[model samples]
Target chain A: MKKHHLRIPGPTEVPEQVLRAMQAPMINHRGEEFTSLFKKVSEEIKEVFQTKNDVLVFPSAGTGAMEAAIANLFSPGDLIVSFSCGVFGDRFADIAEAFGARVERIKVEWGRPVTYEIVRERISKDTKKEIKGVLFTHNETSTGVLNDIKSLREAVGDHPALVIVDAISSLGAVELNTDEWQIDVVVAGSQKALMIPPGLGLVSVSERAWKAVEDSKMPKYYWNFKNAKKSLEKGETPYTPAVSLVYALEESLKQIFDEGLENIIMRHKLLAKALREGLKNLGFRLFAQDSWASPTVTAVDISDFQGKINFSKALKNRFNITVAGGQEKLKGKIIRIGHVGYVDELDIINVLSAIEMILADEELFGKGVKAAEKVFNEGVEV
Target chain B: MKKHHLRIPGPTEVPEQVLRAMQAPMINHRGEEFTSLFKKVSEEIKEVFQTKNDVLVFPSAGTGAMEAAIANLFSPGDLIVSFSCGVFGDRFADIAEAFGARVERIKVEWGRPVTYEIVRERISKDTKKEIKGVLFTHNETSTGVLNDIKSLREAVGDHPALVIVDAISSLGAVELNTDEWQIDVVVAGSQKALMIPPGLGLVSVSERAWKAVEDSKMPKYYWNFKNAKKSLEKGETPYTPAVSLVYALEESLKQIFDEGLENIIMRHKLLAKALREGLKNLGFRLFAQDSWASPTVTAVDISDFQGKINFSKALKNRFNITVAGGQEKLKGKIIRIGHVGYVDELDIINVLSAIEMILADEELFGKGVKAAEKVFNEGVEV
Candidate 1:
């Protein structure tokens, strides 16, 4: 049997146990068994999200949760300050715009993170806090830039505006202290770092978010926060959820907790470091600088070889390693390698080894995999 | 080994093949494998939807698809006539109202079907054709009433109002010719007669509906029809879909085709008829009259044993047979026995015997199971 691996940012490699979890028979969503399972999963999800507030799960993509945050926190014409580094950040801001919000974006170069200096400079202008909310992409998977949401929170500095973070590709892989950072809402997807499929969208709401939700005048039914919260109290969802995916989440959370959150985060960091160093050793430049590079995914700049070589496609055809090509303006300029949920040190080495084989450059190819292995040897237990 | 069965109306029992299908490892959503799979699924879905139009699949419950119909078809403050007979019907209207539609509900008794007479009577009064859309629940799972959409279509003859139907529970179980009925949009769920788990929400859109979509001024992002349509051309979703559920759909659609659509519809009818007759013979009254009784689920009037003896809970506790209790005002008044999606005559007989055992009344106990068997024996195949 041929083996295939997903090295894309989301819908990462589901473990054998987690995949088996999806094979479990369907259960009643409103019944005792599912109620208990949901309650358990809901509680466990918070540990990974690092939130004190309840995480409301929906049966849509991370984008749905992003839309939910926009629709629930503010009304039309609400002023929102969007700090966008790359594609996902732009999408979050775009969602706010689509919902009729007047978004003033603090745009940065694609390969750079949205620093707190720019945030403070803009937020300080809002004396009355006319900006009702702020949107930030914690991890811009497209450009491998991970903005520091904790620092951004401090930049807001007791401003009444809600701080919403799109942690779709970063949550669980990295630390996102929702309550500690005073982040009003954090939207996440099941597929990214949760080791589940792409159906379930999780959103953690703090006390501040609930207050904003009450004042929101937006019209919503399916993604309505009040209905989701009301049902979460009963250990149920307002509508039928992805029951099988929830089962998978239960199993994946068990693996995550077994590995320990701190260990998992460290593992991600080590793997990303190894991959990045290995890529650089192979004569590849990274899109984001080391200071802002994402732990879950790495964007390898291929601008030098854009028309001359096809990096991601070569890996896909030769080794069955599915990596993502760039999007929008970054298209054909960079190749993204995902090392998120269920990926280990060996996975990084294998991908690096494959890249080396694909390139077949005598001087550069042999050095990359060895460099990745060295990182694994120097790091903690793989 | 405990075998728990789901006999709910929405999240019906998934087949073994479909459950196993969910075990397949995650793949990249934007990859070629997924593109081909999506393309094949998109084509196969139309056969069941009975339309030439593209069926947009969302990673949410059927309620989300219902909301998508409301959000994508008509703008805010548009006049809509919602013919509501049950909770879901009322919910469709509520979603329209939540989206700022001027909804005028033609309400009927909970157990009664929304007849053509009621639709025509209301439609004729709107001579100016101010009614932008008409919302109908083809099969009200809450009351086990199946309204005749073809008749309703005739009643709205020559009217420009878009006819939207919530066929979540009835689409695959019963016969629905989307093109023949000229239904502008029909929302369906995966867990029903598709024999998949509760995740995917599918909607078939007509060309007329696309024109309305072009003119729709409603602010939407996740459920935006234009984005979905554009992506459909590329055999991809605008966002990450429930990949496992889509895999399950492929397997389940194969099952659907192998059994043949007409045979599947007949089987659902046979199973429902036997369950209904068995329950009737056991001294249980039906909620919906025989004239408009649904062929997917049967509602047994349990008001007689509401407080005295819990029917659905007793079935669950003693037999591990999960059935649905009534919702909203009908709570504790009826018990719904779902016979759609992977259910056969044997399932009906087994559930009937369990109900008889739970009743334990000498006059009503033995006859129910035997009556179910007679229906099965007279039927062509289980």
Candidate 2:
């Protein structure tokens, strides 16, 4: 039996050092040791978030932070503009609606990126200043599409409405400037680009978003941004934080900062480029548009498979590898291989080799191993 | 420097094996690898929770699930019964109020156990049937008191109100039967007795609680128990769970079951007994009632040193050991030495030895080291 490896996008692979850092004994949250650690980690998280504004670290998944951003920033019946491209995008809309906020969705095709025109049209059409916020996903992991955040920010220029960006998948993996992009509320998770386990939700808030938080009337408690901010002022969390995960995150971010954010982005871009080229060389067409393809994951159209062959399930069954399947409507039609986090050229080669075998079994590849070798040799220009 | 150890209760020592388990590469949440892992973890968690019901795991702290238990089971304006014994108990009330619940708190003295008499009085008084649930903490870590949950259940026998327990610190350390205890909802965390890192909030629901959730009108999204239950049925989470924590928890639970729940409780009891005897021999007095003393932690009264010393901060600074100080009005007035989770005779002896030095410094210990030796020799019966 072969040991399983994670080739999935968001969770990527955790480094041994990061995991070791998390093995520290638990400390009292309100105690002095944790207070110092809490303060330092809060500051370091802000640095990674690329914002001087206070970042609220909740011991929750990205979705929890997404819900917190919504519940604490809007009132019932308030309008929120959400762009939908895939599962997570739809989730934002569904969650906001679930909170009683009327969501105006700018629907984009599945596996397609949200362009500036769509957001511009949505914002411009709002004659009333009723839209409290415009929600966007920086990277649609379900479809592997990266929306133009800068363009969305430009379109919402000077609008009083908050610009909430779900950067759960893109944060450290891609080049994002929450400050420069004018993103009001940018949310990320630990398991993604930070190369840690899933547990912490990092939400960076701007002064503009803080104002909305003060007046927002939605019912909230545990994920209350106001309470979290109040604790942040004292460099603490009102509740017990995941100390080990925070330790892991601190180490992971140290690695990220030491490598320099630019280098981290370049590493991911290089890996993404290599994976895409390798897959294409094996006769696979990318599911996402070339210009908007996510550096974190590449979704390929494996629709040529017979009904019996679900490319997503085949990788797990035959190769002891796990990749994401198309969510909702695209289920079983595509296989998404994520090359984000601590992945490198060698990991890409290994994944591609497995893909080569799976595709060959479906008669979709000729000279399967040779094709992967050609792509690996020519793909990454290190 | 001495190696860091967590004698401060939760976020207790995460075992190396559990740490190694989480160090495995991150798997995609939607992928098959995670699906199987998620399924097994969910089942195992149910076993720990002692319920056949689904347990929803959240990325946030235990407070997140406590809040979830409230928000999902009742709507805004819904009246609920809350018991306030210490900081955490009151926090639940505060959060419920914040979420718009009309909370009726049964106030108990700090450091005092809540009685069945008080619960009966409160329930009998609420003849209006407006009370949707009764919220209480099983272990009040702030004051080292464990409420009589068994009697409290009898007091509310056959009542329509649900019983919710915040077993964050007590769950695996204490004997809690979610089914037999008639506990309608029980919320716990991955830290504490679970011996994992902080990040996951595990909530076990009773069939009765599910009915309340069905009609619950409170505004909720990420903490929605319905979404969690639905996804849990399919062996997945509604959102990306704290994946690595789940893996660590799986390993931790195996250790727990291997030790057996009854024996685990006995170990905690014996350790608490040793710690109390050690402190008493050191010329220190226990704070909470002896009968109600928590097995997880022993809170010591240092009120005698009011103007003489700030032993709270001194212990951590001088010895690099972390213990908790009294919360709220009891600040600097008491110190808590937690002897729970991966702790043994040596840990209790170390804490006792440190207390002797600190006490001698303040002239509180007339015999110093000799006093501690007597306690260490008692050797916790187990």
lDDT of 1 by residue, A16-107 (tens): 68878897999989999998999899999999888878899999999999999999999999999899988899899999999899988889
Candidate 2, residues A172-270, lDDT tens digits: the string is 878788997788999999888889999899899999888988899999999898889889778789888888988888788888887788777877776
Best by TM-score: 1
How many clashes does each candidate structure show, in the order listed? 0, 4
Which run of 10 residues does model 1 chain A get worst, by summed lDDT? A361-370
Q: TM-scores of the models, in the given order?
A: 0.51, 0.50
The alpha-carbon RMSD values of the candidates against the true structure, listed in the order shown, are 26.1, 26.1
lDDT value, candidate 1, whole model: 0.85
Retained true contacts (fraction), each candidate: 0.00, 0.00
- How does the DockQ of candidate 1 come out? 0.01
Question: Where is model 1 more than 4 Å wrong at Cα?
Answer: A1-382, B380-382
| Clash count (model 2, backbone only) | 4
Worst 10 residues of 2 chain A by lDDT: A364-373
Give the poorly placed runs of model 2, Cα more than 4 Å off. Answer: A361-382, B1-382
